[model samples]
Target: MRSVNNHCDLYDFSIWGNEDVSSGKGAKDENFPVGSLLISRKLRPHVQAYYNFARVIDDIADSEMLSSEEKVKRLNGMQAVLCDDVPAPDRADVQAARYLRNSLLETGVSFDTATDLLIAFRQDAVKNRYETFAELLEYCRYSANPVGHYLLDLHKENADIRPAADALCTSLQILNHLQDCRADLIRLDRCYIPLDMLRAENVDVQAVKDEGTISGLRNVFDYILDYIDDLNREAEQLIRLTSNRRLRMESSVILTLACSLTEHLRKEDPLATRVKLNYKDAIKAVLYACPHILR
Candidate 1:
Protein backbone atom coordinates (compact mmCIF):
# COMPACT_ATOMS: atom_id res chain seq x y z
CA MET A 1 0.00 0.00 0.00
CA ARG A 2 1.23 3.48 -0.84
CA SER A 3 1.80 5.81 2.11
CA VAL A 4 -0.62 8.75 2.38
CA ASN A 5 2.30 11.16 2.24
CA ASN A 6 4.08 9.40 -0.60
CA HIS A 7 4.29 12.25 -3.10
CA CYS A 8 6.10 10.22 -5.69
CA ASP A 9 4.93 11.02 -9.20
CA LEU A 10 1.49 12.37 -10.04
CA TYR A 11 -1.14 9.67 -10.65
CA ASP A 12 -1.17 8.52 -14.26
CA PHE A 13 -4.30 9.48 -16.13
CA SER A 14 -3.67 6.97 -18.92
CA ILE A 15 -5.33 4.24 -16.84
CA TRP A 16 -8.74 5.95 -16.95
CA GLY A 17 -7.84 8.90 -19.16
CA ASN A 18 -8.44 12.55 -18.23
CA GLU A 19 -12.05 12.55 -19.23
CA ASP A 20 -14.38 14.11 -16.67
CA VAL A 21 -17.66 12.30 -16.07
CA SER A 22 -19.00 14.74 -13.53
CA SER A 23 -22.74 15.39 -14.02
CA GLY A 24 -21.88 19.12 -13.56
CA LYS A 25 -24.50 19.20 -10.85
CA GLY A 26 -23.95 20.98 -7.54
CA ALA A 27 -25.70 21.51 -4.18
CA LYS A 28 -28.04 24.15 -5.53
CA ASP A 29 -29.37 21.63 -8.05
CA GLU A 30 -30.52 19.27 -5.31
CA ASN A 31 -34.20 18.86 -4.37
CA PHE A 32 -33.54 19.92 -0.79
CA PRO A 33 -31.56 22.92 0.37
CA VAL A 34 -27.86 22.36 1.00
CA GLY A 35 -25.75 24.71 3.09
CA SER A 36 -28.52 27.15 2.45
CA LEU A 37 -28.88 30.61 3.98
CA LEU A 38 -30.33 28.94 7.06
CA ILE A 39 -26.90 27.49 7.85
CA SER A 40 -24.51 29.72 9.76
CA ARG A 41 -22.16 31.57 7.41
CA LYS A 42 -19.15 30.42 9.41
CA LEU A 43 -19.89 26.76 8.71
CA ARG A 44 -21.17 26.85 5.12
CA PRO A 45 -17.72 26.26 3.65
CA HIS A 46 -17.40 22.96 5.48
CA VAL A 47 -20.86 21.95 4.33
CA GLN A 48 -20.03 22.88 0.74
CA ALA A 49 -16.83 20.89 0.93
CA TYR A 50 -18.76 17.83 2.07
CA TYR A 51 -21.35 18.34 -0.65
CA ASN A 52 -18.69 18.58 -3.34
CA PHE A 53 -17.05 15.38 -2.20
CA ALA A 54 -20.37 13.55 -2.18
CA ARG A 55 -21.38 14.84 -5.59
CA VAL A 56 -18.11 13.71 -7.11
CA ILE A 57 -18.36 10.19 -5.78
CA ASP A 58 -22.01 9.89 -6.74
CA ASP A 59 -21.17 10.83 -10.31
CA ILE A 60 -18.37 8.28 -10.32
CA ALA A 61 -20.73 5.54 -9.16
CA ASP A 62 -23.42 6.53 -11.64
CA SER A 63 -21.09 6.94 -14.61
CA GLU A 64 -21.85 4.80 -17.65
CA MET A 65 -18.32 5.16 -18.99
CA LEU A 66 -16.62 3.23 -16.21
CA SER A 67 -16.77 -0.52 -15.69
CA SER A 68 -17.84 -1.83 -12.28
CA GLU A 69 -14.28 -2.70 -11.35
CA GLU A 70 -13.03 0.67 -12.51
CA LYS A 71 -15.75 2.49 -10.60
CA VAL A 72 -14.85 0.67 -7.38
CA LYS A 73 -11.17 1.32 -7.91
CA ARG A 74 -11.82 5.02 -8.46
CA LEU A 75 -14.02 5.23 -5.39
CA ASN A 76 -11.36 3.45 -3.36
CA GLY A 77 -8.73 5.82 -4.63
CA MET A 78 -10.82 8.75 -3.50
CA GLN A 79 -11.27 7.13 -0.11
CA ALA A 80 -7.56 6.58 0.21
CA VAL A 81 -6.99 10.27 -0.33
CA LEU A 82 -9.71 11.14 2.17
CA CYS A 83 -8.21 8.97 4.88
CA ASP A 84 -4.77 10.35 4.04
CA ASP A 85 -3.64 6.85 3.19
CA VAL A 86 -2.35 8.33 -0.06
CA PRO A 87 -1.89 11.79 -1.44
CA ALA A 88 -4.53 13.04 -3.84
CA PRO A 89 -3.81 12.60 -7.52
CA ASP A 90 -4.19 15.51 -9.93
CA ARG A 91 -7.88 14.77 -10.35
CA ALA A 92 -11.03 16.61 -9.37
CA ASP A 93 -12.63 13.76 -7.41
CA VAL A 94 -9.57 12.90 -5.37
CA GLN A 95 -9.01 16.60 -4.76
CA ALA A 96 -12.54 16.72 -3.40
CA ALA A 97 -11.60 14.08 -0.88
CA ARG A 98 -8.57 16.11 0.17
CA TYR A 99 -10.74 19.17 0.60
CA LEU A 100 -13.18 17.27 2.77
CA ARG A 101 -10.32 15.80 4.78
CA ASN A 102 -9.35 19.34 5.72
CA SER A 103 -12.96 20.17 6.57
CA LEU A 104 -13.25 17.11 8.83
CA LEU A 105 -10.06 18.12 10.61
CA GLU A 106 -11.28 21.69 11.06
CA THR A 107 -14.74 20.81 12.35
CA GLY A 108 -13.63 18.05 14.76
CA VAL A 109 -16.13 15.76 13.05
CA SER A 110 -15.51 12.05 12.65
CA PHE A 111 -13.97 10.94 9.37
CA ASP A 112 -16.27 7.93 9.56
CA THR A 113 -19.14 10.16 8.55
CA ALA A 114 -17.40 10.68 5.19
CA THR A 115 -15.92 7.20 4.82
CA ASP A 116 -19.31 5.59 5.43
CA LEU A 117 -20.62 7.14 2.22
CA LEU A 118 -18.00 5.19 0.28
CA ILE A 119 -19.51 1.94 1.48
CA ALA A 120 -22.77 2.83 -0.24
CA PHE A 121 -21.16 4.21 -3.42
CA ARG A 122 -19.04 1.07 -3.62
CA GLN A 123 -22.22 -0.97 -3.28
CA ASP A 124 -23.78 1.15 -6.02
CA ALA A 125 -20.93 0.22 -8.34
CA VAL A 126 -21.81 -3.47 -7.99
CA LYS A 127 -25.36 -3.79 -6.59
CA ASN A 128 -28.36 -2.66 -8.58
CA ARG A 129 -31.31 -4.39 -7.00
CA TYR A 130 -32.60 -4.29 -3.43
CA GLU A 131 -34.10 -7.50 -2.03
CA THR A 132 -36.27 -5.80 0.57
CA PHE A 133 -37.06 -2.45 2.22
CA ALA A 134 -34.89 -3.53 5.13
CA GLU A 135 -31.99 -4.01 2.77
CA LEU A 136 -32.59 -0.58 1.25
CA LEU A 137 -32.62 1.08 4.67
CA GLU A 138 -29.40 -0.72 5.47
CA TYR A 139 -27.96 0.92 2.38
CA CYS A 140 -29.30 4.25 3.65
CA ARG A 141 -27.55 3.66 6.95
CA TYR A 142 -24.27 4.14 5.16
CA SER A 143 -25.37 6.37 2.30
CA ALA A 144 -27.83 8.77 3.91
CA ASN A 145 -27.43 8.64 7.69
CA PRO A 146 -23.90 10.01 7.61
CA VAL A 147 -25.12 13.23 6.02
CA GLY A 148 -27.36 14.04 8.97
CA HIS A 149 -24.74 12.95 11.42
CA TYR A 150 -22.24 15.32 9.82
CA LEU A 151 -24.61 18.26 10.14
CA LEU A 152 -25.51 17.46 13.73
CA ASP A 153 -21.88 17.06 14.65
CA LEU A 154 -21.01 20.35 12.98
CA HIS A 155 -23.69 22.18 14.93
CA LYS A 156 -22.74 20.51 18.22
CA GLU A 157 -26.23 19.04 18.51
CA ASN A 158 -27.09 16.14 20.78
CA ALA A 159 -26.37 12.65 19.55
CA ASP A 160 -29.86 11.64 20.67
CA ILE A 161 -31.25 13.52 17.67
CA ARG A 162 -29.50 11.16 15.26
CA PRO A 163 -32.49 8.85 14.81
CA ALA A 164 -34.67 11.72 13.65
CA ALA A 165 -31.87 12.96 11.43
CA ASP A 166 -31.47 9.47 9.95
CA ALA A 167 -35.20 9.32 9.32
CA LEU A 168 -35.11 12.61 7.44
CA CYS A 169 -32.05 11.72 5.37
CA THR A 170 -33.38 8.30 4.45
CA SER A 171 -36.70 9.83 3.52
CA LEU A 172 -34.95 12.26 1.16
CA GLN A 173 -32.89 9.46 -0.37
CA ILE A 174 -36.00 7.39 -1.13
CA LEU A 175 -37.79 10.39 -2.55
CA ASN A 176 -34.88 10.92 -4.94
CA HIS A 177 -34.98 7.23 -5.84
CA LEU A 178 -38.68 7.43 -6.69
CA GLN A 179 -38.29 10.61 -8.70
CA ASP A 180 -35.40 9.19 -10.71
CA CYS A 181 -36.77 5.66 -11.01
CA ARG A 182 -37.19 5.68 -14.77
CA ALA A 183 -33.96 7.48 -15.48
CA ASP A 184 -31.98 5.21 -13.19
CA LEU A 185 -33.35 2.12 -14.89
CA ILE A 186 -32.57 3.47 -18.33
CA ARG A 187 -29.19 4.98 -17.58
CA LEU A 188 -27.53 2.82 -14.96
CA ASP A 189 -29.77 -0.29 -14.87
CA ARG A 190 -30.04 0.45 -11.12
CA CYS A 191 -33.23 0.13 -9.11
CA TYR A 192 -33.85 1.36 -5.59
CA ILE A 193 -37.39 0.05 -5.22
CA PRO A 194 -37.24 -3.16 -3.27
CA LEU A 195 -37.62 -6.32 -5.35
CA ASP A 196 -40.01 -7.81 -2.81
CA MET A 197 -42.36 -4.87 -3.13
CA LEU A 198 -42.34 -5.17 -6.92
CA ARG A 199 -42.97 -8.89 -6.69
CA ALA A 200 -45.80 -8.28 -4.25
CA GLU A 201 -47.33 -5.76 -6.62
CA ASN A 202 -46.83 -8.12 -9.54
CA VAL A 203 -44.81 -5.48 -11.31
CA ASP A 204 -41.74 -6.27 -13.33
CA VAL A 205 -38.61 -4.21 -12.78
CA GLN A 206 -38.66 -3.30 -16.46
CA ALA A 207 -42.07 -1.71 -15.93
CA VAL A 208 -40.29 1.52 -14.99
CA LYS A 209 -39.02 1.75 -18.56
CA ASP A 210 -42.55 2.22 -19.80
CA GLU A 211 -43.71 5.54 -21.25
CA GLY A 212 -45.76 6.04 -18.13
CA THR A 213 -46.10 4.34 -14.76
CA ILE A 214 -48.34 1.29 -14.98
CA SER A 215 -51.03 0.72 -12.39
CA GLY A 216 -48.89 -1.85 -10.61
CA LEU A 217 -45.92 0.51 -10.48
CA ARG A 218 -48.13 3.31 -9.24
CA ASN A 219 -49.31 1.04 -6.43
CA VAL A 220 -45.71 0.35 -5.50
CA PHE A 221 -44.98 4.07 -5.58
CA ASP A 222 -47.88 4.71 -3.23
CA TYR A 223 -46.60 2.03 -0.86
CA ILE A 224 -43.20 3.69 -0.77
CA LEU A 225 -44.77 7.10 -0.27
CA ASP A 226 -46.75 5.81 2.68
CA TYR A 227 -43.50 4.69 4.26
CA ILE A 228 -41.95 8.07 3.53
CA ASP A 229 -44.91 9.72 5.24
CA ASP A 230 -44.07 7.78 8.37
CA LEU A 231 -40.43 8.82 8.09
CA ASN A 232 -41.41 12.47 7.73
CA ARG A 233 -43.52 12.14 10.86
CA GLU A 234 -40.59 10.67 12.73
CA ALA A 235 -38.26 13.35 11.41
CA GLU A 236 -40.52 16.03 12.84
CA GLN A 237 -38.86 15.52 16.20
CA LEU A 238 -35.57 16.87 14.87
CA ILE A 239 -36.80 20.45 15.01
CA ARG A 240 -37.56 20.21 18.71
CA LEU A 241 -34.48 18.19 19.54
CA THR A 242 -32.04 20.56 17.89
CA SER A 243 -31.02 23.26 20.36
CA ASN A 244 -29.28 25.51 17.82
CA ARG A 245 -31.75 28.02 16.43
CA ARG A 246 -30.42 27.94 12.88
CA LEU A 247 -30.21 24.15 12.88
CA ARG A 248 -33.72 23.95 14.29
CA MET A 249 -35.01 26.18 11.52
CA GLU A 250 -33.05 24.22 8.94
CA SER A 251 -34.41 20.92 10.22
CA SER A 252 -37.96 22.23 10.21
CA VAL A 253 -37.65 23.47 6.63
CA ILE A 254 -36.15 20.21 5.43
CA LEU A 255 -38.87 18.20 7.13
CA THR A 256 -41.52 20.38 5.54
CA LEU A 257 -39.84 19.96 2.17
CA ALA A 258 -39.76 16.19 2.60
CA CYS A 259 -43.45 16.13 3.44
CA SER A 260 -44.33 18.33 0.47
CA LEU A 261 -42.29 16.20 -1.91
CA THR A 262 -43.94 13.07 -0.55
CA GLU A 263 -47.36 14.43 -1.40
CA HIS A 264 -46.16 15.38 -4.89
CA LEU A 265 -44.75 11.90 -5.45
CA ARG A 266 -48.06 10.38 -4.38
CA LYS A 267 -50.03 12.28 -7.00
CA GLU A 268 -47.58 12.46 -9.91
CA ASP A 269 -46.40 9.64 -12.18
CA PRO A 270 -42.61 9.67 -12.11
CA LEU A 271 -42.35 7.62 -15.27
CA ALA A 272 -44.50 10.15 -17.08
CA THR A 273 -42.59 13.09 -15.59
CA ARG A 274 -40.46 14.13 -12.67
CA VAL A 275 -42.31 15.31 -9.56
CA LYS A 276 -40.75 18.34 -7.85
CA LEU A 277 -41.66 20.96 -5.28
CA ASN A 278 -42.61 24.28 -6.75
CA TYR A 279 -41.89 27.80 -5.49
CA LYS A 280 -45.15 27.72 -3.54
CA ASP A 281 -43.89 24.67 -1.71
CA ALA A 282 -40.65 26.51 -0.88
CA ILE A 283 -42.69 29.37 0.48
CA LYS A 284 -44.62 26.99 2.65
CA ALA A 285 -41.43 25.40 3.91
CA VAL A 286 -40.11 28.77 5.01
CA LEU A 287 -43.40 29.68 6.63
CA TYR A 288 -43.48 26.42 8.53
CA ALA A 289 -39.86 26.79 9.63
CA CYS A 290 -40.21 30.39 10.79
CA PRO A 291 -41.65 29.43 14.17
CA HIS A 292 -38.64 27.24 14.88
CA ILE A 293 -36.31 30.16 14.27
CA LEU A 294 -38.30 32.43 16.58
CA ARG A 295 -38.38 29.89 19.37
Candidate 2:
Protein backbone atom coordinates (compact mmCIF):
# COMPACT_ATOMS: atom_id res chain seq x y z
CA MET A 1 0.00 0.00 0.00
CA ARG A 2 3.01 2.25 -0.26
CA SER A 3 2.60 5.27 -2.47
CA VAL A 4 5.21 5.88 -5.16
CA ASN A 5 4.76 9.60 -4.63
CA ASN A 6 5.79 9.34 -0.98
CA HIS A 7 9.37 10.32 -0.13
CA CYS A 8 10.53 6.77 0.59
CA ASP A 9 14.01 6.61 2.08
CA LEU A 10 16.28 5.44 -0.74
CA TYR A 11 18.88 4.47 1.87
CA ASP A 12 16.46 2.05 3.56
CA PHE A 13 17.94 -0.88 1.72
CA SER A 14 17.48 -2.86 4.96
CA ILE A 15 13.73 -3.33 4.56
CA TRP A 16 14.14 -5.87 1.73
CA GLY A 17 17.74 -6.75 2.60
CA ASN A 18 16.57 -9.46 5.02
CA GLU A 19 16.06 -11.83 2.09
CA ASP A 20 17.05 -12.22 -1.54
CA VAL A 21 14.28 -11.75 -4.10
CA SER A 22 16.26 -12.66 -7.18
CA SER A 23 14.48 -15.20 -9.37
CA GLY A 24 17.74 -17.15 -8.78
CA LYS A 25 18.03 -17.26 -12.55
CA GLY A 26 21.43 -16.78 -14.11
CA ALA A 27 22.96 -16.21 -17.55
CA LYS A 28 22.44 -19.83 -18.56
CA ASP A 29 18.85 -19.64 -17.41
CA GLU A 30 18.20 -17.14 -20.16
CA ASN A 31 16.72 -18.12 -23.50
CA PHE A 32 19.92 -17.08 -25.27
CA PRO A 33 23.55 -17.65 -24.47
CA VAL A 34 25.50 -15.27 -22.23
CA GLY A 35 29.26 -14.82 -21.99
CA SER A 36 29.43 -18.11 -23.82
CA LEU A 37 32.51 -19.71 -25.33
CA LEU A 38 32.13 -17.63 -28.45
CA ILE A 39 33.23 -14.54 -26.51
CA SER A 40 36.90 -13.99 -25.74
CA ARG A 41 37.78 -15.54 -22.41
CA LYS A 42 39.49 -12.40 -21.14
CA LEU A 43 36.32 -10.31 -21.60
CA ARG A 44 33.92 -12.91 -20.27
CA PRO A 45 34.19 -11.66 -16.72
CA HIS A 46 32.98 -8.22 -17.73
CA VAL A 47 30.06 -9.75 -19.62
CA GLN A 48 29.16 -11.84 -16.58
CA ALA A 49 29.35 -8.79 -14.37
CA TYR A 50 27.06 -6.82 -16.63
CA TYR A 51 24.64 -9.75 -16.84
CA ASN A 52 24.57 -10.11 -13.08
CA PHE A 53 23.83 -6.42 -12.70
CA ALA A 54 21.06 -6.55 -15.27
CA ARG A 55 19.60 -9.69 -13.69
CA VAL A 56 19.49 -8.10 -10.27
CA ILE A 57 17.70 -4.95 -11.45
CA ASP A 58 15.26 -6.97 -13.57
CA ASP A 59 14.37 -9.13 -10.56
CA ILE A 60 13.71 -6.01 -8.49
CA ALA A 61 11.20 -4.83 -11.05
CA ASP A 62 9.51 -8.21 -11.38
CA SER A 63 9.25 -9.04 -7.67
CA GLU A 64 5.67 -9.56 -6.51
CA MET A 65 6.56 -9.21 -2.85
CA LEU A 66 7.73 -5.60 -3.07
CA SER A 67 5.31 -2.77 -3.52
CA SER A 68 5.92 -0.52 -6.51
CA GLU A 69 7.31 2.12 -4.18
CA GLU A 70 9.78 -0.30 -2.60
CA LYS A 71 10.86 -1.53 -6.01
CA VAL A 72 11.58 2.02 -7.18
CA LYS A 73 13.45 2.86 -3.99
CA ARG A 74 15.68 -0.20 -4.24
CA LEU A 75 16.33 0.45 -7.89
CA ASN A 76 17.31 4.05 -7.11
CA GLY A 77 19.66 2.83 -4.39
CA MET A 78 21.29 0.41 -6.79
CA GLN A 79 21.69 3.16 -9.38
CA ALA A 80 23.21 5.46 -6.80
CA VAL A 81 25.70 2.75 -5.94
CA LEU A 82 26.53 2.18 -9.58
CA CYS A 83 27.22 5.88 -10.08
CA ASP A 84 29.46 5.98 -6.96
CA ASP A 85 27.03 8.28 -5.14
CA VAL A 86 26.82 5.83 -2.21
CA PRO A 87 28.47 2.75 -0.80
CA ALA A 88 26.93 -0.61 -1.68
CA PRO A 89 25.16 -2.44 1.10
CA ASP A 90 25.93 -6.07 2.00
CA ARG A 91 22.90 -7.19 0.03
CA ALA A 92 23.64 -9.35 -3.01
CA ASP A 93 21.54 -7.22 -5.30
CA VAL A 94 23.19 -3.99 -4.24
CA GLN A 95 26.59 -5.64 -4.38
CA ALA A 96 25.89 -6.51 -7.99
CA ALA A 97 25.89 -2.81 -8.81
CA ARG A 98 29.30 -2.43 -7.17
CA TYR A 99 30.71 -5.35 -9.14
CA LEU A 100 29.55 -3.88 -12.44
CA ARG A 101 30.86 -0.48 -11.41
CA ASN A 102 34.31 -2.00 -11.05
CA SER A 103 34.00 -3.84 -14.31
CA LEU A 104 33.03 -0.67 -16.19
CA LEU A 105 35.99 1.15 -14.71
CA GLU A 106 38.33 -1.63 -15.77
CA THR A 107 36.93 -1.83 -19.31
CA GLY A 108 36.25 1.88 -19.92
CA VAL A 109 32.75 1.16 -21.18
CA SER A 110 30.30 4.01 -20.64
CA PHE A 111 28.07 3.75 -17.57
CA ASP A 112 25.16 4.95 -19.66
CA THR A 113 24.83 1.52 -21.23
CA ALA A 114 24.20 0.09 -17.78
CA THR A 115 22.12 2.97 -16.43
CA ASP A 116 19.79 2.86 -19.43
CA LEU A 117 18.50 -0.54 -18.33
CA LEU A 118 17.31 0.97 -15.07
CA ILE A 119 14.94 3.14 -17.07
CA ALA A 120 13.15 0.05 -18.37
CA PHE A 121 13.14 -1.72 -15.02
CA ARG A 122 11.62 1.38 -13.43
CA GLN A 123 8.95 1.37 -16.10
CA ASP A 124 8.29 -2.31 -15.44
CA ALA A 125 7.76 -1.57 -11.75
CA VAL A 126 4.72 0.58 -12.58
CA LYS A 127 3.75 0.38 -16.24
CA ASN A 128 2.06 -2.83 -17.40
CA ARG A 129 0.21 -2.18 -20.62
CA TYR A 130 1.85 -1.01 -23.87
CA GLU A 131 -0.50 1.10 -25.93
CA THR A 132 1.31 0.67 -29.22
CA PHE A 133 4.16 -1.20 -30.88
CA ALA A 134 6.23 2.00 -30.95
CA GLU A 135 5.84 2.32 -27.19
CA LEU A 136 6.96 -1.26 -26.73
CA LEU A 137 9.99 -0.59 -28.91
CA GLU A 138 10.77 2.43 -26.77
CA TYR A 139 10.70 0.15 -23.74
CA CYS A 140 13.00 -2.25 -25.50
CA ARG A 141 15.30 0.66 -26.38
CA TYR A 142 16.08 0.94 -22.70
CA SER A 143 15.44 -2.66 -21.61
CA ALA A 144 17.02 -4.51 -24.51
CA ASN A 145 19.08 -2.12 -26.66
CA PRO A 146 21.49 -1.24 -23.87
CA VAL A 147 22.47 -4.90 -23.81
CA GLY A 148 23.57 -4.66 -27.43
CA HIS A 149 25.34 -1.37 -26.77
CA TYR A 150 27.27 -2.96 -23.91
CA LEU A 151 28.41 -5.89 -26.01
CA LEU A 152 29.40 -3.72 -28.92
CA ASP A 153 31.39 -1.45 -26.62
CA LEU A 154 32.93 -4.43 -24.89
CA HIS A 155 34.14 -5.84 -28.19
CA LYS A 156 35.17 -2.47 -29.65
CA GLU A 157 32.78 -3.04 -32.48
CA ASN A 158 31.80 -0.11 -34.65
CA ALA A 159 28.90 2.06 -33.59
CA ASP A 160 27.39 1.61 -37.04
CA ILE A 161 26.61 -1.97 -36.14
CA ARG A 162 24.21 -0.74 -33.46
CA PRO A 163 21.29 -0.49 -35.85
CA ALA A 164 21.59 -4.19 -36.54
CA ALA A 165 22.28 -4.95 -32.90
CA ASP A 166 19.22 -3.01 -31.85
CA ALA A 167 17.19 -4.93 -34.38
CA LEU A 168 18.33 -8.27 -32.98
CA CYS A 169 17.83 -7.24 -29.36
CA THR A 170 14.40 -5.77 -30.02
CA SER A 171 13.43 -8.89 -31.93
CA LEU A 172 14.47 -11.07 -29.03
CA GLN A 173 12.54 -8.86 -26.61
CA ILE A 174 9.33 -9.12 -28.61
CA LEU A 175 9.83 -12.86 -28.97
CA ASN A 176 10.09 -13.18 -25.20
CA HIS A 177 7.00 -11.02 -24.76
CA LEU A 178 5.13 -13.30 -27.14
CA GLN A 179 6.33 -16.48 -25.46
CA ASP A 180 5.52 -15.20 -21.97
CA CYS A 181 2.35 -13.32 -22.87
CA ARG A 182 0.07 -15.67 -21.00
CA ALA A 183 2.25 -15.97 -17.93
CA ASP A 184 2.88 -12.23 -17.83
CA LEU A 185 -0.83 -11.49 -18.00
CA ILE A 186 -1.88 -14.11 -15.47
CA ARG A 187 0.88 -13.59 -12.92
CA LEU A 188 1.61 -9.86 -13.15
CA ASP A 189 -1.53 -8.59 -14.86
CA ARG A 190 0.91 -7.15 -17.43
CA CYS A 191 0.43 -7.26 -21.12
CA TYR A 192 3.21 -6.37 -23.57
CA ILE A 193 1.04 -6.93 -26.60
CA PRO A 194 0.04 -3.63 -28.12
CA LEU A 195 -3.43 -2.75 -26.89
CA ASP A 196 -4.37 -1.14 -30.19
CA MET A 197 -3.58 -4.29 -32.12
CA LEU A 198 -5.62 -6.37 -29.68
CA ARG A 199 -8.57 -4.03 -30.18
CA ALA A 200 -8.08 -4.07 -33.92
CA GLU A 201 -8.35 -7.83 -33.79
CA ASN A 202 -11.25 -7.64 -31.35
CA VAL A 203 -9.29 -9.52 -28.67
CA ASP A 204 -9.46 -8.58 -25.03
CA VAL A 205 -6.35 -8.54 -22.86
CA GLN A 206 -7.85 -11.25 -20.66
CA ALA A 207 -7.98 -13.56 -23.63
CA VAL A 208 -4.38 -14.40 -22.79
CA LYS A 209 -5.59 -16.16 -19.63
CA ASP A 210 -7.41 -18.76 -21.67
CA GLU A 211 -6.03 -22.26 -21.96
CA GLY A 212 -5.73 -21.97 -25.71
CA THR A 213 -5.23 -19.24 -28.25
CA ILE A 214 -8.42 -17.82 -29.68
CA SER A 215 -8.70 -16.82 -33.33
CA GLY A 216 -8.59 -13.11 -32.51
CA LEU A 217 -5.54 -13.59 -30.33
CA ARG A 218 -3.88 -15.61 -33.06
CA ASN A 219 -4.30 -12.69 -35.42
CA VAL A 220 -2.58 -10.43 -32.93
CA PHE A 221 0.28 -12.92 -32.56
CA ASP A 222 0.75 -13.03 -36.32
CA TYR A 223 0.74 -9.27 -36.43
CA ILE A 224 3.63 -9.11 -33.99
CA LEU A 225 5.49 -11.99 -35.67
CA ASP A 226 5.34 -10.27 -39.02
CA TYR A 227 7.07 -7.27 -37.47
CA ILE A 228 9.68 -9.57 -35.97
CA ASP A 229 10.36 -10.87 -39.44
CA ASP A 230 11.30 -7.37 -40.53
CA LEU A 231 13.54 -7.02 -37.51
CA ASN A 232 15.36 -10.27 -38.24
CA ARG A 233 16.00 -9.11 -41.77
CA GLU A 234 17.70 -5.97 -40.42
CA ALA A 235 19.48 -7.98 -37.75
CA GLU A 236 21.28 -10.00 -40.38
CA GLN A 237 23.60 -7.06 -40.86
CA LEU A 238 24.97 -7.52 -37.34
CA ILE A 239 26.97 -10.55 -38.36
CA ARG A 240 28.36 -8.71 -41.34
CA LEU A 241 29.13 -5.45 -39.56
CA THR A 242 30.98 -7.02 -36.67
CA SER A 243 34.77 -6.87 -37.07
CA ASN A 244 35.71 -9.35 -34.40
CA ARG A 245 35.62 -12.93 -35.58
CA ARG A 246 34.35 -14.35 -32.32
CA LEU A 247 31.71 -11.66 -32.02
CA ARG A 248 30.66 -12.29 -35.58
CA MET A 249 30.23 -15.95 -34.83
CA GLU A 250 28.28 -15.13 -31.71
CA SER A 251 26.09 -12.67 -33.57
CA SER A 252 25.45 -15.23 -36.29
CA VAL A 253 24.42 -17.80 -33.75
CA ILE A 254 22.11 -15.42 -31.91
CA LEU A 255 20.62 -14.16 -35.13
CA THR A 256 19.90 -17.72 -36.12
CA LEU A 257 18.30 -18.39 -32.76
CA ALA A 258 16.17 -15.26 -33.05
CA CYS A 259 14.94 -16.29 -36.48
CA SER A 260 14.29 -19.83 -35.31
CA LEU A 261 12.36 -18.61 -32.29
CA THR A 262 10.37 -16.29 -34.48
CA GLU A 263 9.41 -19.24 -36.66
CA HIS A 264 8.43 -21.19 -33.57
CA LEU A 265 6.19 -18.37 -32.39
CA ARG A 266 4.62 -18.14 -35.79
CA LYS A 267 3.73 -21.83 -36.07
CA GLU A 268 3.08 -22.61 -32.43
CA ASP A 269 0.47 -21.27 -30.04
CA PRO A 270 2.30 -19.82 -27.06
CA LEU A 271 -0.88 -19.87 -24.95
CA ALA A 272 -1.30 -23.62 -25.38
CA THR A 273 2.29 -24.44 -24.46
CA ARG A 274 5.79 -23.06 -24.21
CA VAL A 275 7.16 -22.17 -27.61
CA LYS A 276 10.92 -22.02 -27.44
CA LEU A 277 14.06 -23.18 -29.17
CA ASN A 278 14.93 -26.85 -28.76
CA TYR A 279 18.06 -29.01 -29.18
CA LYS A 280 17.55 -28.96 -32.94
CA ASP A 281 17.55 -25.19 -32.82
CA ALA A 282 20.80 -25.21 -30.85
CA ILE A 283 22.42 -27.47 -33.41
CA LYS A 284 21.24 -25.19 -36.18
CA ALA A 285 22.63 -22.12 -34.43
CA VAL A 286 26.04 -23.75 -34.05
CA LEU A 287 26.06 -24.87 -37.63
CA TYR A 288 25.15 -21.41 -38.78
CA ALA A 289 27.88 -19.97 -36.62
CA CYS A 290 30.48 -22.33 -38.08
CA PRO A 291 30.80 -20.47 -41.35
CA HIS A 292 31.64 -17.31 -39.45
CA ILE A 293 34.22 -19.02 -37.25
CA LEU A 294 37.14 -18.46 -39.62
CA ARG A 295 36.03 -15.03 -40.67
RMSD of each: 2.6, 3.4
Per-candidate Cα lDDT values, in order, are 0.88, 0.88
TM-score of 1: 0.94
Model 1, span 252-271: residue lDDT tens: 88899999999998888898
What is the TM-score (0 to 1) of candidate 2? 0.95
Cα lDDT tens digits, model 2, 1-295, are 0122332455565745677679999876778999999999999999999999999999999998888888887887777778754654587877898899899988989898988999899999999999999999999999999999999999998898899999999999999999999999898888999999999988889999898999999999998899999999999999888999998998999999999999999889899998989999999999999988777
Q: Quick one: best lDDT, which candidate?
A: 2
Q: Which residue pairs in candidate 1 have backbone atoms (N, alpha carbon, C) closer than 3 angstroms, thus clashing?
A: 4-85, 4-86
Q: Stretches of candidate 1 above 4 Å error?
A: 1-16
